[model samples]
Target: MEQSFPALPGQAALPGLRHRLSTRIVSLSLGALLIVLAMISGTLWLSWQLEGAGAAINDAGSLRMRANRVAIELARAHAGERHQLDAQITGMDATLARLRQGDPARPLFLPDDPGIRAQLERVSHDWNQRIKPSALADLGVATGEAPAYPAALAAFVDQVNRLVSMIEQENATKTTLLRLSQAGLAAMACMGTVAVIYLLYIWIILPVMRLQDGLQRMAAREFSLRLPVETRDEFGMLADGFNRMAGELEGLYQDLEARVAQKTAELARHNRDLAALYDMAALLNMPNDSEALCRGFLERVMQQFNADGGSVRMIDADHGQLHLVVSAGYSAALEEAEHCMRVDACFCGEAASESVVLIEDLSKGAALSAGRPASDARFGCAREGFPGLAVFRIETQRTVLGTFSLHFRQPLTLPASDIRLLETFGQHLGVALDHLHLSETARQLAVVEERNLVAQGLHDSIAQGLNYLNLQVQVLEDAVSRSDMDETRTIVPLLRCGVEESYQDVRELLLNFRSKLAHGELRQAVEDTVARFRRQSATELALAFNDAQGGPPLQPEQQLQVLFILQEALSNVRKHARAGHASVIVRNGRTFSMVVEDDGEGFDPMEPAADDQAHVGLHIMRERAARLSASLRIVAARGTGTRVELILPR
Candidate 1:
């Protein structure tokens, strides 16, 4: 769930910033530097022009003095003064030429003014023509030979003075221009400095300050705050980025509570589903009959689904019928009427064939109002005032056991999650029902086996005793018919003994038949049998029992068989072996073992019995041991006690 930054209207249509901050600052600095350089260059040029003006004025004044000196030297000319006159004239001509050609190396050049140039030319001409000729005319002659030298020299001095004044005036003008240029340079420097500072603040510093303020606000969790995009620079992009981030954060914070609430609801529903599943599994594991298990399952399921009524119906496959095993929130008459239904009957039967069936608004009026073809076919649920019904198949992976129907008081539609949960519950019910069927089958098999054993016991003991009584009576009848009193008396005693023995056998059989392993407690049954045996024989009997910890306990059938074997062994010891002492030892360990021992004049266990009746108990004991999948051994020798030992399988 990534969202792009929202842009302002028409923002995308704008062009990028052409003159970035860096480019503008660099341009401003370079312009300021160029202005300063130009100002300094102008001032230096003015100073150079003014420099030569002062030297030109000094040269003009010297021309006036040199002219006067030449005139004096002429007036005083003698043969020795002739050389002095010539030298003065030559020095003046040199000065004139030097001024005319200006010395650039010495920075002595005339100003670029028309008036100053004319003055300099006049000075050079006067010195070279008028002063030089006048002075040279009388240089080699007598003193009187000089021609009006004093007057002419004075006129030439006046001309030189005028030239000096003009040079001074030009120098003054240049000096003024130099001073004004310096002032302008100072002003430009000050202005450039201020401009640079203001530009830097506007371009860099101001934006930076605004960005810092925005960050502080953001840090304070003010997500609604946004920075204005003043310029299209990097800082502008930063502002945009910050605004986008704030929008996203605000959006997330706004919906955070809603998302958390949704997650909490989902978690609560999940926990509830888990608890329901655990409770249902526990209910199925209970050791209850099919009817009770189904009844409890229906009641709990109805409560879970918030249904007004519900019923659990099992399929009687052989009869092609659905039998209602349990019902809740239903009228007694309705329960009785709907107790049994054919395979092709109503919603329950249909649900058995399918996985699920949901029927809403089953009322006759609503169905007819909806104009449905099956409107008139409204079933028992509609008549029973349960308009809404949901039927789920109770099924395993391999088979469908039956259907459980939930009846709603009002029209209802279940959500997918609820429907899924109901299906899971149906599978659980299917498994439980299957287990109940298996347990019932096993109980029936145990009953049949016990009945057969009882019949066998009756035929082996009581039946045999009855047959012997019949033979004895026949023999007595023969003796009585012959009028043989001696034979009759002997027969009569035998008959009483035979009848007494038969009665005793019948009682023993009855006792043995009634002996049951209550609650599958083998040890208790053994103790009771041993006590009965001791009382009957008036013999000293000891019973020892030991059960090791963590031993695998015997099943009910195995325990019952073991008890019967012990009973048979004790009976044999009491009736046949005239033993003074007998003991029954029982041990429960990795394998169960029971031994019944007596000290009596014992016979060989390997020898064949004289008749079937004599060894019937032993045969029966061996049969019971075989049924337990255990080992049975009879240890006996002459003049030693007999020991019957039974060891059951692990």
Candidate 2:
């Protein structure tokens, strides 16, 4: 079995199976630390060497001073001033001894070179052999011979000067060597530091960065990505684990995607079902005939279910037979053959009788062909050569309305869900058909009621006008029989006037029955009416419309009534009042108001006798206004002009 490794939390797994990163880091750090320590040690050693060199140079300078003092003492002795001559000689000897062998207490300069030491030995021998003997002889006795002592001392001082110069030169050389060593140590330290840094980058930083990049890709759901496992370490194990996790996640995502696709297909099917039922409901609501509605329903069912063809068969209650009202995607021969059938003769009819749905696969030829003769090829649906059929009974709560049949080219067994949806569709179709039937019945009733109203109106207006003219004619005949010329002339005009008035009443009634407002616009119709009257009447007619707050208040029927009232008022002004000017004012506000006023000979409105000819016009206006739920007021006196005002609430 292969061992599995779990990744660490908050940090990537270390490469533990290979060289430990910590060890490498510690080694690099220690290397750097060692380099630093070596640099410090080298610096200290160089500083010490420089200090020693400086001390040597200073001692060599002191030796030169001692040599000069010896020369000076020799000069003084030669000049006969021998006061401290012996002391100066002793100091020169002591400085030479110190130069030859270094004195720790005085810290005198000494050279390590053999050549310088041999030169120093020769100088000591020269000093001791010649100059010292001369100086000592000068200090002890007269010896006033100026006995070559100054020349010997000068030679000794020159040798001491040469020794000091050699010591200084050696010290400068050592200082230069120390400085070079320090510079070399510093360069080595810097190079070591750079090498350690480069090692650390290769060993730790680069590997950690690669692991971090792999983690980022995983976080972003790039599961197909894999980290390179270049070592047998913790990072390598983590890469293996990451690859495993990515594989698992990829597998899960594929499964989830497949499930989502399946669900989407199901949702799409449900939506199509809903949309098909909605379209069928809309077709049923339309004012199409039964055949058109059936055709639309069949087509929608076929398209929604992917059927090759379909038919709707309605039962004719009178004939007690099934009739194919509409079909889609069927040959003409098949359509004609299946146009009509007995209630118990066909599959659709059988489904209608049973009031249940049936699904058939004709390719099996099992239950469908039971008890059928071999030579009887007159089957309705069989002639179509369909592989499958689904017949659903469309029925309301009270009655079975029809049968819906779908035929498919291939054998198909509908799922339970689809069957349930089809059944629901059928039920909705039945309900819609019932609603349409009720609406048609209501429409017929409305027509009958409107005809009754029209008949009543004719009886009240035109019939009354004819009766009045008949009475006037009887009076005219009586006047002619008496042979009274004046009475005859008066009766003739009254008779003629009655005939004209009756004629005007007939025309007005006809116009009222036939005239309809254009597009149901009350204002435009009123304007047209005023224009017509202005063209015909001698009375100067004016129309004023004021509807600034709201729109027109009256409905189409109410507007028509108002128009008729206006016409009656204008006719009265033209025939009876004989007015020169008349105006119609229509104002729409919170309430609607129409006023008709005329500047003419006004009559007493309060004393409108039943026999008055103007009374008929007033009656008609009052009746029309009452129908509108409005108030009609006739304001007039013996001399004042008449004003008819009609007001209705909005």
Number of the top candidate by lDDT? 1
Record all residue pairs in model 1 with backbone atoms less than 3 Å apart, i.e. clashing: none
TM-scores of all models? Answer: 0.72, 0.49
Tens-digit lDDT string for candidate 2 (624-646): 78878999999987767899999
TM-score of model 2 (CA atoms):
0.49
In angstroms, how far off is 295's CA in candidate 1?
A: 4.3
- Candidate 1 is scored at a TM of 0.72
Which runs in model 2 stand beyond 4 Å of their true positions?
A: 1-203, 212-222, 230-233, 252-287, 314-323, 328-384, 392-403, 414-439, 461-506, 519-550, 553-558, 561-586, 594-648
Scanning candidate 2 in windows of ten residues, the lowest lDDT window is: 369-378
lDDT of 1 by residue, 203-311 (tens): 7888889889888987898889988888876677777777888898889877886898988998898788889999999999999988889988998899998999998
